[model samples]
Target chain A: MVKPIIEVFDLTAAYGDFVLLDKVTFDVRRGEVFVILGGSGCGKSTLMKHLIGLLRPAAGRILIDGGDINNASGQERADLLKKFGVMYQSGALFGSLTLEENVMLPMEEFTKLPPEARRLVARMKLSLVGLERFSGHFPSEVSGGMQKRAAIARAMALDPEVLFLDEPSAGLDPVTSAGLDELILRLNKNLGVTFVIVSHELASIYAVADRVIMLDQTKKGILAEGAPGELRDHDSNPFVHAFFHRETAEVAG
Target chain B: MDFNQKTGCLKLGARLDAGEVSALWSAVGGRVRHVDASPLETCDGAGLALIWYVQKGGATVTGLRPEIAALLRPFDHLPVDPADAPPRDNSLFGQLGRAASQIWNDTRDQVAFIGEFTVTALRCAVSPGQVRWGDMWVIAQRAGVDALIVAGMVSLLTGMIMAFQSSVPLKQFGVDIFVVNLVALAILRELGPIMTAVVLAGRSGSAFAAEIGTMKVNEEIDALVTMGIEPMRFLVVPRVLAGFLVTPVLTVYANFLGVAGGFFVMMALGFPFMALWNQLVSAVGVTDVMTGTIKSFVFGILVAGVGCLRGLQTGTGASAVGVSTTRAVVSGIFLIVLVDAVFAAIFYTIQW
Candidate 1:
C-alpha cells in the first residue's frame, strides 16, 4: 500500500483543562481533496493549526509526507511548512505588498531565484488563480474574491506537494465558491498535490471533496469518515446525514 | 431538533463577527465590503448609515462580473480613501500622511519577518545596535522636521520673553552681562530638552501610536505574523531610533535661540551686545550644555520607545488607536521625567 502523505495517530490536543481534539486518528493520502467538516467551536481550525505545526498536540504524533512534525525542531517544522501551501481562512495577505508582491513573497524568502525569475513565477501563479492582471493591485484595491485568489497564488508559489486550506470558500458567494472548488480539483489532478481543507461550506464540499471527515461535537472525536456519497447513504447518525447533504438541505428546510 | 439534523455547522466562519453589519458580512468577508462601501456613502450624523447609493456600485460591479473593476479603477468616491492601501500605505509618504498608521505597522512587520535574523541580531545588545541607521533617517526626516517646526516657533517666543523679562534686572544691576548665561544655560540644560521632548511626545509620538494602533485593531498584525514577519524590527525600531538621534539637535537649537533672546534684551537695556556676549561666555561652562544634550538624547529614546511599545499594545478595532495614542504620549512624558530625576540624583551624588 502507498504511504499516506499525512498521518495523525491517537492525537489528543488540549488547552488548559479543555480537550480540543481527542484521539483523532486519520490519514490523508496524496493527490486528493479531503474536507474536514465541523461547527465553529468544534476545534476544526485548531486542528488545522496543529496539522501545519502552528500548534502542538498534547498526545500523539503528526507526520507530514511521512516525516514526524510532533517531534521535529522549529527549523525542521518551518522546512516542513515550506512543503505545503496554506491559504489562510482570513486570506492573510501582507498589507505592504501589492498583489504581485504578496504572491512573490514565498519565492523571495525560500528560493535563491533572482528578481526576474521570481516575478515570472509570481505572474504564472497569479495566472493560475485567474489573477494575472491584478499583479499591481494591493489587497485593498482588489475585491474579496481576488484577494483570496492572490492568497491562493502565494500559497502555490513554492510549488508544494501538500496544501492546507483553512476555509477556502468561507465568505464567497455560491458562484465564486464553485469556481474555487473547480480550481482545487484542477490543482489536485494537475499538480498531484494533497489538499487538507477545513471548511463547513456545504455547496463547495459536495461540489469538490472526494472524502469527508466529520468532527462530531457530542462525541468530541470523529463521528464518521468516508466518501461523501457513502456517508450520506449509510451513516445512521442524523448529524452525519445533515452534513453530507448540507448543500441541498441547508437553505430549503 | 436532533444534534445532526440542526445543520447549523456551516456558520462557524461567520461567528467571529462582532459588528453592526453581521447580517451582511462575516469574518474576512465583512471588512473588505465595508471598506469598499465607505466610498459610496456619506455621513450626516446618522451614525455611519449606508445610503441606497452605496449598493449601486456593488450591484453594477457584481453584475458586470469582471469588466467593471477594470473600468472604475481610477476614481475614489470617499474622502481621504481611509488613509490605508498598499504601495500608498507602504511608502515613506504614506507613513507620514496616512490616517491609518496601524496598517503600515503590519506591513513593516512582514519586512521584519523576511529579514528576521538580521533584525534579531542587530536588536540584540551584543553590539548595542538598539540604534539603527534606518531609524536615524526616519527620525532625521520625519521627527526631525516636526521638532524643528515646533522648537523654532516656541524658541522665537521664548527668546522674545527673555529679552522682555531681563531688561528690568539688567537696568537696575547693570549686570546685564549675566542675562545671556541665565537664558543659555537654563534653556540648554533643563528647559530645552525637556520642553522639546514634551511637545514631540504630544505631536509626533502620539501620531505614531495612533497610526500603528489602528492597524493592530484591523488584523493587520495577524497578517504580518502569518507571512513570517516581525512587527518589532519593521515598525518599532525605525521610529525609536529616529527619536533617539534627533531630540538632542532640537534642544541645542533651542539653547542658541534663548541666548539670542537674552542678547536682544541686554542690548535694548543699553548693555552692549559685545559685553553681554563676553560675560555669557565667561559665566557658562561646557558641562551645562553637555548635561542638557545628554538629557535630550535620553528623552528622545523614551518618547520613541513609549510610542512604539504602546502602538504594539493596541488591540483590534478603530477605538484602540485613540487609547494607544493617549498611552504613548502620557507614558513618554512620564518616562522622560523619571529619567531626568535619576540623572539629577546621580549628578548630585557624583559631585559630592
Candidate 2:
C-alpha cells in the first residue's frame, strides 16, 4: 500500500471554548482524491483548516510526511505550504490583480523562473482550468465560477503535491459545478496530484472522490470512512446512510 | 523498471508534463546518460527542456522516435525573447479621467452619507434613548479619554517650545512677560484645537476607519443590512456623538496643559508665577476659549465623519482596509485644516 501523504492523529480543533472537531483521525493517501463529508456544522471545514495548518489543533498532531505541522517553525510551515495548495470557499483571489497576475504571484514568490517563464506557466495553469481566455480579467469582472476556476489555477501554479479545496462548488450552478468536478478528476488523473476536498455535495463526492470520511455533528468525529460506493452500500451509521441516500430527517441522526 | 542501468537508458512516463518534468528528470540524473524515447508516451515544452538540460550535462539522447525528437527540438535551448511586459495603466489622460471619476464618486458618496448621518443625529438629539449609551461609553473611553495623557504631553511640549522661541526675541527687548500672553492666546484660540484634531486623526480617526473597514471586509456590514439595522444609526451615530462631546473637553484639557507649560517656561526666564498668570488672564478673554471650543467641535465632526465615510466606502479585499485607513487620516487632516482656515476667516471678519 502507498504511504499516506497526510496523517491526522487524534486531531482536536476548537475555537476558544467551542470544540468543533474532537479527536478525529484520518489519512489521505498520495495521488488519491480524499473527500471530507459531513452535514452542515459538522466541522468538516474546521478539519480541513487544521490539515492545511491554518488553525493549530487544540490537541493532538497532524503530520505531513512524518513532519508535525502543528509544531513546525514559521519557515517550516511556509515550506510545508508550498507542498500543498488551498482554494478557499470564496475563491479569496486578490481583487487588485488580474487572474494571470494572481496565478503568477506564487511562482514569483517560490520559483527562480524568469518573468517570461512564469507568465508562460501562469498561462498554462490558466489553460488547465479552462480560464486562459480570462487571464487578463480582474476577479470582479468574471463570474463566480470563473473566479473559482482562477483560484484553482493560482493554487496549482507551484505544482503542489497536494491540493486542498474547501467547497469549490458552493456558489456555482449545477452545470458549472459539474464542469469543476470534471476538471478536478482530469487534474488528479493526468497530473497524479492528490486532492483533499471538504464538501457535502453528494454529486461531487461520487464524481471525484476515491475515498471519503463522513464527520457527524453530534459525535464530533468520523462517523464513516471508506470508498464511496462501499460506504453508500453498507455503512450502518444513520447519518452516513441518510446522507448518501439523500433521505429525509426521519432516518437521519 | 523505466531506468535500466546496464543499457544507460531511462524511459519517460506516460504524462511527461510540466509538474512531473523536474522530479522525473532529477530522478534520472546524469548517471543514466542515455534517454530511450522508444517507450516515451507524452511530453510538453517543460519536459523537453528538462531533457535538454540533462543532455547538456554530458548525457546523450538515443533511440528517439522522429516525432518526439521534433517535439523536443524547440525547447533544446531557452527562448531568447524579452521578459513578459508588466501590466500597467500608462495613459496620462486615462489616469486623469479615472481619478476625476473616482473623486466625483467619493464626493457623491460623502454627501449621501452626511445626509444619512444627520438624520440619525437628529433622531439621537430628539429621542436620546435610540442611541446605545453602553456603546457610546465604551467608544468614548477607547477613542477619547484614553488619549488624554499623550495629548497632554504633546500640547505641553508645543506650548513650552513656542514660549521659549518667542521669549528669545522678547528677552532681547526686555519684554519677556509678553511671552505669556502670546502663548495663552495661541493655545486658547488655535493651537489647542488644531493639535487635538491632529492627534485624534492619527489615533481614533484611523482606528475608526480600520475597525469599520475590517467589518466591511468581513461582510458584517452586509449582515447588518440583512438584519434590517441601519448601520449609519447603529454604528456611526454613537461614534459621532462621542467625538463631538469628548473633543471639546480634551481641547480644554490641552489648553490648560499648554498654559501650565507656558508658565513653567516664564519662571525659567525669571518672571514671577503671578505675573505670568495675570498677563495670561488679561490677554485671553471668553471669546478665545469659545473659539477654540467651537473649532474643536467642528474638527471633531470632520474627523469622525471622514473616518466613517472612508470605512463605509471601503471596497473588497485585505488591502481595501489599509487604503481606507490611509484615506481617513489624509482626508481627516485636510478637512480639519480647511475648516479651521474657514473658521479663522469668519472669526476675523466678525472681529470675534
Candidate 3:
C-alpha cells in the first residue's frame, strides 16, 4: 500500500457553538488525486480550511508528512506550509501582478534562485498550464478560465508536494472545467504531485478523483468514501446515492 | 544532482524537486550536453523544467523510465523561442508616453462624467420626485453630522494658532487686542470653508469613491445599467446634493468654533469677553460670512463630484477600488485649492 501523505484523526470542525464535522477521520495517500465532496452547507469548505490550517479544529489532529500542523509554530509552521499550496475558488491571483510575476512570487520568496532562473521557472510553469503566451497579462485582462489556469501555475510555483484546490471549476463552463480536470490529471500523473481537491461538481469529480470522501450536512461527517465509479454504482447511503445520481430524494409522507 | 564537465553527463538524484533543481541549475549553469536519468526515481515540475531547459540548450537525455518520458513528451512541442514574450517597454520615453496617455484618458473621462452629472442634476431639479431624498438624508448624516467633532476640533486649533501667532507680533506693537479682528475675518472668509472642505475631501470623498468603486468592480453598476436605472440619478445625485447642502452648514459650525477658539486665546491674554465680542461683530460683516459659505458650496460640489467621478471611472480587479479612492482624495483636494484660487481672484477683482 502507498504511504499516506496526510492523516486526519478524529477531527472536529466548528464555528463557536455551530459544530460542522464531528470527529471525522480520513487519510490521503501520496501521489493520488483525493477529493472531498458534499452538498451545499455540508462543511466541505470548512473541513478543507481546517486541513490547510486556515481554521483550527475543535478536536483531534491533522498530520501532514508526519508533522502536526496545529502544534507547529513560527518557522516550524512556515516550513510545514512550504510543503503544500492552495488555489482558492475565485482564482485569487494578485491583481496588480503580471501572470509570470505572480508565479515567480513564491519562488522569489522561498528560494535563492537568481532572477533569470526564477523568470525561466515561472515561464516554464506557465507553459505547463498552456499560459506561457499570456505570462505578461494581468489577472483582469484574461478570461475566467485562463485566470484559473494562471492561478494553478502560481500554486505550482514552488513545486509543493501537495496542492489543495478549493472548487477549481466553480464558475467555469463545462468545456473549461474539463480542460482544468485534464490539466489536473496530467499534473498528477506526470509530476507525481498529490492533489487534495474540494469540489461538488460530479463531472469534475468523476473525471479527476482517484478517491473521494463525501460529507453530509445531516450526518455532520463523511457519509461515503471510495472510488467515484464504485461509489456511484454501489454506495448504499441514500444521501450518497441521491447525490451521485443527481436525484431529488422523495421524502416519506 | 551532479554534473561532470569532461563527460558532459548530468546525473540527477532520487528526489529532484524545486529546491534541489534550483541549486543544481545555479551550479551547472545549463552547461550539460547529455543527461543520464537512470538513477532518477522522481522529478517534479521544476525538475522537468530543468530537463526541458537542458533539452532546449541542445542536450541529449537517455535512460528515462517510460512514465517520466511521457511527462517530458508534452513539453516537447511547445515553442522554446522567446519571441512571444510580453513587451515591458520601460524606457524613459516609453514611461513618459504612457503617463501622458493616461492623463489624457483620465481628463476625457472626467469631462464626460461632469457632463452626465450636470444633465442628471438638471433633470432631478426639473422633476424633484426623481431625486432620492432618503439616500440624500442618509448621506447627509454621514458626511455632515458624523464629521462635526473632528471639524470643530480642527477649526478650534487653527483659530488658536492664528490668534497666538498674530498676537505675538501685534503685542510688540502694543496692539494685541487686534487679534480678535484677525481671527474673525480669516475664519469667516477663508479658513472655515477651506478647512471644512479639506476634511470632507479626506473623509467623505474617499468613502464615496470606495463605495461606488466596489459596486463598479462587482458589476452592480452594470446591473443597474442593464435594468435601465441611471446610476447618476440613483447614486451620484444624492451624494452630491448632500455635500452641496451640508458643507455650508458645516462651515457655519466651523466658523463659530474657530471664533470661539480665538475668544479663548483673547480671554487668556486678559481681554474681556464683551470687548472681544464687540470687536468680532464690528470686524466680520454678513458679506464676509456669505463669501465663505458660497465658497464652501462650490468646494462641496468639487469634492463630491470628483469622488463620484473617480468611482464611476474605476477599472477592474482587486486594486481598482484602492486606486479610485486615492484618486478621489487627491483630485478632490486639487480642485478645491484650484477653485479657491479662482474665487480669491474673483473677489480681488470685484473688491468685495
Candidate 4:
C-alpha cells in the first residue's frame, strides 16, 4: 500500500471553550481526490485550517508529507504552505490584482523567475483552468465560476504537489458545479497532484471523490471515511446513511 | 431550477451591474437600489467600500471638497490611449483643458476620500455616551504617564546639556547667575510643549491611525454601519476628546522635565547652587506654565482628530494602511502648527 502523504491523529480544536473539531483522524493518499464531506459548520473547514497550519489542533498532530506542520517553525511552515495551493471559500483573491497577477502571486513570492517568465508561467496556469482569455480581467470583472477557476489557476501556479480547495462550487449552478467537479478529477488524474476538497455537495462528492471522509457533526467530526459507494451501501450511522442516500442520483442511463 | 439549461444566466449580469444600492430597499418609498458591482463579476468591493468609508470618516477637509464629485462626469468613461499621442494637440487651450480636467479628476478622488473618511469616522464614533468619561480618563492617564516618563528621561539629558552649554557661556560672561533663569523659562514655556507634542504626534498619533485603520480594513466599520450605528460617536469623538483633555496635563509634565533639564545643566556649570535655585525660581510664573499647558491641550486635540480622521478614511485592505498612517502624522503636525499659530495670535492680541 502507498504511504499516506497526509496524516492527522487524535485531532481536536476549539475557539476558547467552543469546540470546533474533536478527535478527527485521517490520512490522504498522494495524488488522489480526497473529499472532506460535511455540512456548513461541521468542522470540515476547521480541519482544513488545521491542515494548513492556520489553526493549531488542541490535542493532536497533523503530519503533512511526513512533517508535523503544527510544530514547524514560521519559515518552515510558510515553506510547507507554499507547497500547497489553497482556493479559499471566497477565493480570497486580492482585489488590486488582476486574474493573471493573482495567479502569479505565489510564484512571484516563492520563485526566482524574472518578470516576463513569471507572466508566461501565470498565463500557462490560467490556460490550464481555461482562463487565459481572462488574464488581465480583475476578479470583479469575471463570473463566479471564472473567479473560482482563476483561483484554481492561482493555486496551481506554484505547481504545488498538494491542492486544498475549500468548497470550490459553493455558489455555482449545478452544471457549473459539475464542470468544476470534472475539472478537479481531471487535474488529479492528469497532473499527479493530491487534492483535499471540503464540500457537502453530494453530487460533486459521488462524481469525483475517490475516498470520502464524513464529519458526523453530532458525534464529533469525520465520522466515516471510505469509498462513497461503500459508505452509501454499508454505513449504519443515520447521518451517514441520509447523507450518501441522496436518492442514489437516478442513473437515467 | 435548471436556469442555466434555459439561458445560462439570462444576462442578469447587466441587471446586477446596473443595480444600485438604494434599489435593495425598494419595498417602501424608495427608488431603485444601487447594489455595488458584484464581487464575482469584479472585485470592485474595495472601491465601493472606499466610497462608504470616506463618507463615514467625515472627509470634511480643505482639499477635494465634496463638490468635486460632480465636476468629473467624464472620469468614469476613461478613454484608452495607445503608444503615440496625436502630435498637434498641444495647443494652449488643450493644455488648459487637460490641466482643468486633471484637477477635476483629483477633486473627484478627494471627494471619494472625504466619503471614505466620514464613513469610517461615523463607524468609530458610535455610542459616544457609553464610554465618554472612560475615554477621557484613559487619554488623560496616557498623556500624563507618557509625558512624565518622557520628561524625566529628557530632563536628565537636557539638564546635562544645559549644564555643559551654559557652563562655557557663564564662564565666558563671568555672570553665571543667569544660566538657571535661562534654562527654566526656555524649557518651561517654549521648548517643553513643542517637543512633547512632536513626540506624541509620532508615537500616539501613528498608533491611533494604525489601530483604527486596521479596524477599517477588517470590516469592523462595516459591521458598525450595518448595526445602524454611527462610528464617529463611538471612535472619533472619544479619541478627539481624549487628546484635548490629555494635552494640557502632558504639557505641564513636559515643562517640569525641561526645567529640570536646564537645572541639571546649571548645577554642572560651576554656578553657586543657591544662586542657581533663586534664578530658576524667579523666572517661572504660574502664567507661563499655564499657557504652555493650554498649548499642549490644543496640540493633543489636533493630533487625535487628525489621526482618527485619517484612520477612518483608510481603505478596506492592508495596502491603504501605510497611506493612512502617513496622512495621520502629516495632518496631525500640520493642524498642531496651524492651531499653535492661531493661539499665538490670540495670546498676543490679548496681551494686556
Clash number for each model: 9, 0, 0, 58
In model 3, the runs with Cα more than 4 Å from the true position are: A251-253, B1-15, B33-39, B61-67, B83-97
Q: What is the full ranking by DockQ, best candidate first?
A: 3, 2, 4, 1
What DockQ does each candidate score versus the true complex, computed on alpha carbons?
0.01, 0.25, 0.50, 0.04
Top-scoring candidate (lDDT): 3
Off by more than 4 A, model 1: A74-78, A245-253, B1-352
Candidate number that wins on DockQ, 1 or 2: 2
Cα misplacement distance, residue B242 of candidate 3 (Å): 1.8
Tens digit of per-residue lDDT, candidate 2, span A1-253: 8779999999888899988888988899999999998889999888988888878899998988777877888888787887888999999999899898999998778655555556666766777788766778888779989999999989988778899999999988999999999999988876778999999888889999999998987888999999999999998877678989999768676
Model 4 chain B, poorest ten-residue lDDT window? B24-33
lDDT of 4: 0.69
Candidate 3 per-residue lDDT over residues A1-253, each given as its tens digit: 7669999999999899999999999999999999999988999899989989999999999999988899999999988998898999988999899899999999889887777778878887888899888988889989989998998899988888899999999999999999999999999987788999999999999999999999988889989999999999998888788888888866311
Candidate 1 colliding pairs, count: 9
Cα lDDT tens digits for candidate 4, B1-352 = 0113232221112221112322321221112122222222321111222223223333221222232233222122322211122244589998999999977975675576557545654655574345557766776666457656765566556655765677676768787666666667666666677777777787778878888899898888889888986676666666777777766766776667666666656655455667767776687677777777778877877788778767877875466788889988888778777877787787778761
Best by TM-score: 3
Predicted structure 3, TM vs. truth: 0.94
Residue-level lDDT of model 1, residues A1-253, one tens digit each, is 8898899999887897799789999999878899998866888888888898888889999899877876777888777877788989778888667887887777667665555445655665676677766788777668777788888888887667789898988888988888899988877775566899999887787778888898866677888898877888898877777766654335423
| Root-mean-square deviation of candidate 1 | 21.8
